[model samples]
Structures are given as structure tokens and as C-alpha cells.
Target: MTTSEQLHLPAGSTGRGNYETIIDPGAREGWVHTGLRVLALAPGGSEVVTANGVEAMVVPLNGACDVAVGGEDHHLRGREDVFASATDVLYVPVGSQLTISSKDGGRFALATAVATGSHPVALIRAEDVPVEIRGGGNMTRKVRNFGTVGAFDQMDSLIACEVITPGGNWSSYPAHKHDETVDDGDHQESELEEIYYYEIQDGPSGPGFGFHQTTSSGEDKPIDVLSEVRTGDTVLVPHGWHGPCAAAPGHDMYYLNVMAGPDPVRAWNITDHPDQTWVRGTWESAGIDPRLEGEAR
Candidate 1:
């Protein structure tokens, strides 16, 4: 993998004994403040996860698991996979430790970020997650707001969420950026470093693939990343305008987005690229792709 490819981690590239992939702030020099780790285990397998100074959420991408935090065990009724449904999640605050074990083998994601203050451990139920369909027609997609500023009000800097785009459709359209803090009355934007961990469903015949692009929002900072992503791949956005994550003709795409930064106030404010802002108006007439139902299934 090239340096850029390194940032776009493919499955199995960062595997350690029990973990399938690991990307921490320490691993990325220029990148700071956010981290992620994917753990996979066999039946009756378990791993001890601890947050030294960082706060993390135990999100089950596939299968149910038990998270033991602060001497209490919380059973997470997870889904068969990201496509199945929104799964239960557990929040682990800074300076805390936990153990996650699964009855049957499955995978879990630890979405983390640097913390400024401490918070009590919280269990977020799947039904409590606000499920919404954003955009319309082909651009339509499902969003599970489990760890956003408005969804769960307990984190310090971390903002996490998930999106599912049906095959042959686009999500995160109209390239937008949040790399700068803009605080003008009603107009507000917060600087945030983001990570996109993708999982593509199988095509009719074989494996599946998708695409993601991130380019410099302006002349000052030139960043470019266009990758053909597969299941278990990740794209990091340190700074730029990112959008139009497209799922292939027969492959649906699911991504877990983890974001955080130095911003004192945690908010997701973004400025769309001037060239792509017009796309929003078109969505009104385009009608959402029928493949995506109005509600989360």
C-alpha cells in the first residue's frame, strides 16, 4: 500500500492477533485526535478494551455481544450485520476499561476520540436511535444517529454515525467540508477530522465494490483521495471536501463515520462546495430512489 493507500486501510492490513484492523491517532502522524479499532473473535471469544484518556463507543457491526464496563455487564442486542438494523451501543468514558465477548463469532467497532471532560457510562438502545432518510431518489440513504451531537448527549468530542446507501445510488453528495470553524450568527461550522469505514454487500455474483472521493476544499490546502472501496476498507479525511460516496450497480454500501477535532463546541456544520451546491435543488425533483424505503428496515 502506498502512503495514501495506507491512510485508506483495506481489510486485514492492520490485523494483530485478535483484532482485524487498528488505526489510532498515534499511527497517523499528521492526523490527530480520532481513532478506530475493529475486533473480530470466534465463538466464546473475548477481548479487554480500555480507553486510557480517550472515550469510545462499543458498536457491534455484526452479531450480539456483552460489554463489561465498570463491573457491570451490558448485553448488546446487535444485528446480523450493518444492513440488518441499527444495533445497541455502549459508551465508555475516559479512564475506564471494558471487556467485550461474543457468544458466536462476530465483529465490533470501537469508535473513539480525545476527551476534554468525563461522562458516565451510558447504554444506547437500538430503538432510541433516530433513523432518518436523507436526500431523495438516487441520493436517498438511511442515517442512524446514535452518536451525533443531537442524538446522544453525552460525549466530549467524538461524533459518530452510520449511513447505508442502496446499490446504484449516491450518498454524501454535494461535496462538503467542515475543516474550518465558521461562527457567523446562524451560519456555523466546526473543524473536524473524519473517518469512513465501509462495508459493501455482495453483488449478485461475487464480491462488491464502491467509490469515495475527497479533494481539497480550496487552493490553500490541496488534498486528493479517490478510492475504489470494498468491505473492510477505510477512508480518512484530515481536511477537504468529501462526497458522492457511490455504491456499485448491485452492491449496497454501509459506512460508519467517526469524527472529532479541536473544536471546543461539538457540532457538524459544513460548507458545500460552490460547484456542487446546486445538486441539492435537483434532489427535490429527482425523487428518492425507490430501493431505499422511507423507514429503516
Candidate 2:
């Protein structure tokens, strides 16, 4: 009998009835190979997915849709949220037979995993997303690799992306960790399984919140979460040692990282927290956060 309800999963509590929020892998107990769903349609809503063995990725957490499968017809144009900018994506393969429409509705973000192999079905637009801007002062953040691992490389075991932390920033700090598949030789990590879907921007006191942390880089994976996230929150990192994810002072943060596991390759090795790993070498002289300046793509 395991417990802790599998880390924090607030905000409307995973629309258990269906879309609007749905974490897969049966939603807990060391959640397997990643999963997520956050449909939220309305004006002329539509849905008809059947992602049998997983391998999805239709991110657009804000609006616009129309993603038929097989015979093709993808078209997303989403934006006006997730900090607006870098939208459009669609890559449904593995068991197929999907369909989605949204004449005026919004909120999408499906991002699954599990398929052993099979990568094709593409789309990825938004000026070819790939705007990395990692830490610096205030621990800057603003990554949007689109379907990660060298920015989109046709997928299999999904590993999506989306992050933007401003407003008193401090995202995923020195408290790193990737679960560990190997690399105990010096420090390299693997073994994914992560998911954090959030969005919180509304300062002047209408509604907003931020702050997420994961602990237990010991006791053989026993985790301890500290959450306060809002705007459709959902944090689940099967193993521990997460990070800052702050963004509060005025509120302006966003998340959308959905990782995978059973790693054979699809890299992304992490491993900080060894006494704070020297604070990541002071971020090359700390000096970045200007609201991520000019939004470089």
C-alpha cells in the first residue's frame, strides 16, 4: 500500500471526468511513462481522441485547433497565454484516430508518452520554436524547445517543453535531479518521468499563485512536495529533488514540461543538489533577466 497520493495535483483536481485536466499512467503511484491532457473546449467544442498506446503532443494551451489524424489536416495557431508567443504544434502518431476542433474555444495541451518507437506526424510551427534562455540573475528562465532533445527531433517517448518565469523569478534552481538511470561515475543522470503543467499570471490580486518544490533525493525516491501553484496546477515528478519554480512577487509564471522514461537514449540528464552544485557556477557571471530581453528566438 503506497500513499502520498502521488505528489501535489491541485487546480480543479485533474478533471477526473475527462478533459480540462487529466494525468495519465493511471494518475499516480509512481506514475509510469508520463501523460497529461488539458482540453477545455467550449464554442463549438469537439474531441475524438484514441491515443491507444501513447505518443501525442498537441500543445497550444490557449486556443485555436483542428487536428485530424492519419489523413492529415493539422492546424493550431494557439497563443494569448503561456506568456503569448511560440505556439502551434501537433504530432499525433501511435494508434492514431484523433480529431479536435475549437471554433472559438481554447486550452489544449496533450503531451503523452509510452510508445516504444514511431515518429512522424509533424507540424511544429510558431516560427520553429526553440528559444532557450536558461538561468542567470534571479535565476532567469524562458525555454520553449517545442518537443525537446535538440529542439524537435521527431519523437517517440514524448518530452515536451514550455517554461517562462519572470516576476520575481527563480525557476528550477540548483535542486536538480533526473531520477537516475546511471552515471554514478561522476554525475550525469537519466530516468525521466516528470510533469508540471501550470499557468499563473494575474497579479493585482485577482487570482494567481506560484511556488513548487520536490524533495527526497534520498530514502530511495521517497518524495515530499511543497506546492501552492494555481491556474490549473499539476505537479508530479515520480522521483524527487525538483526545484524553485517560484515566481510570486507580482505573479507571472508558466510551466508545461512533460517528460518521459525507460530511457534508452532521448537524453536530458540532470543531477544537481550535491550541496547545491556550486549554484551552477554562478551562471557565468549572473546578468540576464531583463524580462528575458527581446524574446530571442
Candidate 3:
């Protein structure tokens, strides 16, 4: 058993009123900015979202849908599954009516932040999603930037992205932390709470599984989480060094990351662990794994 299974929320464990799965900052004591909601709809089903003080990003986890926001319908051509390809997304600013409907049944994930910043609504297409191949060798993985910082900078605090690690590979490598708030106009990590929502690809035998690790960074913010994550499972990072998630030999892994913080500047600042920082240097010589090139296409 991994240390501190307290942070691991298995599938169907966090359901609340109206949503099948919901995680809200206001609902959790001491958590201030981030929120996530998973909504499932039957064919021809519809619902209005009441995210009054929050800016939200609608990501379709499976199947297609139409997002009605700002008096317009933003049709999303969602993928068959998370492992297929990057899906379309919609951004809704605060104080707006957000409604979603699908002719065919599917599930959607709403990544949100408690914010008041003003930004126009955007209908981001799937082809426009930036695909990044990061790390090298077995540490290699593909990152899809949908609501990430530089990719889509309309919101105030929300920063979200998708990562796909091939079978038998590792990602979020060389353990890193972004738990300290520093403002000297120089180097310092920003404090942010992160959410990792996982979806593992199935193998020939059965449903897939993987291992996740997040330990303390010795910065007084203690955390210890070693979880065997599966589809629809989630892990919360309040503060710690998180990295080196391992996908089982026959299973590929996909995780959507939702992040937000108290900082005014919308930036992702992180500090790699001193001991494993050296792993980055090796990437200079190590080429990317060939399997990712085909899958990312």
C-alpha cells in the first residue's frame, strides 16, 4: 500500500447534488481556488450550469456536444475517448449562463476557477490544440495544451492541460514542486493546488492501472501519496514534490491536470527536486521515444 491514500479519490466517490462527480474549493475546507465537475448526459439531455463566481472551461471527455454560452451554440466535435485525440473546448467567463446538450450520450468535464476577471468566450477547436512532445526516452510523453497558460490565457486563475504517457513509460518526471509563494522579481515557485484526473487505456486482459507518487519536498508542507490510479480516479496535490507516474507495461495513461492559485499573475512556476534535476540534463542527449510520434499524430 502507498503512503497516505487520503488524497486519492476513486471513481464515483465524490458525487454531489446535480453533478455525478464534483470537487469545489468552497466545498473543501482550506482549498481556495480550483474546482472540477463531471457531468454525464443521456441522449438529448441538457442542463444549465450555475458557476456564478467562477470562470469555466468545458472539456468533453467523450462524445460530441453543443455548448450554449453567451447566446451562441459552440459545437464541440469531441473524441471517442481521451486516448483518441485532443478534443474541442469552450471557455466561459464569470456571470454567464453555461448550458450543455448532446444528441448522443456522453460525459463532460468542467475545469473551473473561482475568479472575477473579464474575458470573452472562446470556442477552441481540436485542430488548434497545441500538441507538445516533452521529456525523452522512456520519460517521454505528449502534452495537449487546451487551457494551459500560454495556450489559452483568457481566464484569471485556471490553468489546465492533458498529458498522455505511453505504456511502460513515465511522466511528470524528475519530481517538481510549486508550493512556495515568492515575489522578489526573481526565481521562486508559485503556490498552487493541482488536480490530476486520470483515464487509463485498457489492455487485452482487462481494465488498466498505474502508480502515482507524490512525497514531501521538505518545505514544511507535508504530503505523502502513492496511489494506484485508474479511469475516473483523481489525486489532489495541495503541496508537495509530485512526479514520476508510471504506466503499467500493457497500459497507456492519460491524465487531465487542473491548476489554480492565489497569485495574480497567470504563470506556471515550478522548481524541480535538487536530486532529480539532473535527469533534465540527460534529455539533451536522449531522443524522444518513437511510439509517441505516431500516437500524437
Strongest candidate by lDDT: 1
Q: Record all residue pairs in model 3 with backbone atoms less than 3 Å apart, i.e. clashing.
A: none
- State which candidate has the highest TM-score: 1
Q: How many clashes does each candidate structure show, in the order listed?
A: 4, 0, 0
Which candidate order results from sorting by lDDT in descending order?
1, 3, 2
The candidate 3 region of ten consecutive residues with least summed lDDT is 1-10
Tell me the lDDT of candidate 1.
0.88
Q: How much lDDT does each candidate structure score?
A: 0.88, 0.82, 0.87
Write down the TM-score of every candidate.
Answer: 0.96, 0.34, 0.95
Candidate 1 to truth, TM: 0.96
Candidate 3 residue-wise lDDT, 150-239, digit = tens? 899978889999999999999999989888787677677788889899999999879999988899977477778988999989888888
lDDT of 2 by residue, 1-297 (tens): 122355677777768544868888754655889898898888788888888888898887888888888887888989878787889888877778788888898878898988867777888888888898987888888888889888886877778888889878888898888887877678678889889888889977488788888888877667777878888888888887898789887888889989989977888888888877787789869878777876767
What are the per-model C-alpha RMSD values against the true structure? 1.8, 17.2, 2.0
Q: Candidate 2: how many backbone clashes?
A: 0
Instruction: Give one digit per residue, the lDDT tens place, for model 1 in 1-297.
Output: 123564677888877988887888756677788888999989999998879778999899998999998989999999999998899999999878899999997999999998869999999999899998888878888999999988897889999999999998888898899999989898888899999999999976899999998887778767778899999998888888888799998899999999999988888899888898888898878876777666853
Which pairs of residues have clashing backbones in candidate 2? none
Give the C-alpha lDDT of model 3.
0.87
